[model samples]
Target: HTSYVLGCAFSPNGRRIITADLDNKARVWGAETGECQLIIGEHTHDVKCCCFSHDSKYILTSSWDHTARIWKATDGTLMNTLRHEAGVDSCAFSSNDKLIVTACHDKIVRIWDTERGQLKHTLAGHQHSVRSSSFSADGNRVISASYDRTARIWDANTGDM
Candidate 1:
């Protein structure tokens, strides 16, 4: 990438790496050979974060283009796109890799069903842009930090504070 590399993560098994870039692309690389294996480039704006699922079979990415996407890790096939009302700042997969969480500039934290790519919950309460989010170890709760000067926790299944 000619521009900034915002984030990068190694796969759980340590054989591959994924990177998020300002060039509107996410790239998968072979860790051993250091070669670019695949370019997952569907986002129209800068990608802010990228991560591999706990089992290392899937990739999840967040973008300033107001979407989060999931892809097949082995071949870089696009699996799902989760749309948001504003730029997405971050995203993560649940412990079991069955759920996804995203933080957005719209002040909302969203929970998504990984299998159907459906919106499962909209965690609303932050007074400013949500900057980051992650699921609990059990995947039953979500924690988010916001520009609103607060960090909040919510029930991942219920979207409750």
Candidate 2:
């Protein structure tokens, strides 16, 4: 039912799991029973990463199609999309849930306002693809890891790399 698993995440409550695949799909599964609960197949290219919101109310999936989409966790409803200039590699919710961090193959990490879907910052410094990124506990800083063999800390609000 899929090509290859790229990334996966457990819902905040730990009851559900979401898997991103190269098949251009993301599937929600019952963690305990291993049952496929929902299938999200809207992306036109390989889905790179998938994750749950901090409150477990939503799911977000990033893709090589240059979009990171948010969906309702319970019903699989499309909520919002974060589009980038290049293939997005990963996305994650801020610790406080006010923002999302998206890393891309364009050697940049972008911070997006979750509620407004506005671009916050574009952190540019890495020489290779930004493999992943996340916010610090205070949500004021960002940490990004790259295939460039370096991990950097940036100012989340300013995009200072």
Candidate 3:
């Protein structure tokens, strides 16, 4: 159906596809047939990114509206809303699935507790907008790249340098 897709992610099992769009919506669909399934639409601005959780039951979306939202994959129910100081550029779930990290135009990187939707820590050092962020393979640290011409490493638990 020519979805206005901005980003797409496959479920862990590869059975479903989750997509985010500039239209401020995210949808879940059948991977093989491209059949539209669930649709999530609460974002006030363009959805820039989305990802399926490790278990494939949830979808995470980052938007220009300065927030990241978590949704139930099956029914598109809102699960959690994560806010940042500025527009969120990207988000990633930790490999262990316990934490979520978001990079924002506010020049900060933030870590959140996935289940509780609580702010775990904020990593601040970038002099310009943060472009991307990710958790280390060991899940003990986070790495962030910024337009500030630098990349930083922080303790995952404390967001310390």
lDDT of each: 0.95, 0.92, 0.89
Ranking by lDDT: 1, 2, 3
In the order shown, what is each candidate's alpha-carbon RMSD?
0.9, 1.1, 1.6
Model 3 Cα lDDT, one tens digit per residue, 18-80: 888888888888999999888788999988889988877778999999999988887888999
Query: Which candidate do you rate higher for lDDT, 1 or 3?
Result: 1
RMSD of 1: 0.9
- lDDT: the better of candidates 2 and 3: 2
| TM-scores of the candidates in the order shown | 0.97, 0.95, 0.93
Candidate 3 backbone collisions, by pair: none
Residue 34 accuracy (lDDT) in model 3: 91
Q: 1-161 in candidate 1: lDDT tens per residue?
A: 77899989999999999999999999999999999999999999999999999999899999999999999998889999999999999999999999999999999999999999999999999999999999999999999999999999999889999
Candidate closer to the true structure by TM-score (higher is better), 1 or 3 = 1
TM-score of 3: 0.93
Best by lDDT: 1
Residue 87, candidate 2: Cα error in Å is 1.0
* Model 2 lDDT tens row, 46-82: 9999999989988999999999998988888898988
Candidate 1 local Cα displacement, residue 28, angstroms: 1.0
Give the count of colliding residue pairs in each prediction.
Answer: 0, 0, 0
Off by over 4 Å in 2: none
Query: TM-score of predicted model 2?
Result: 0.95
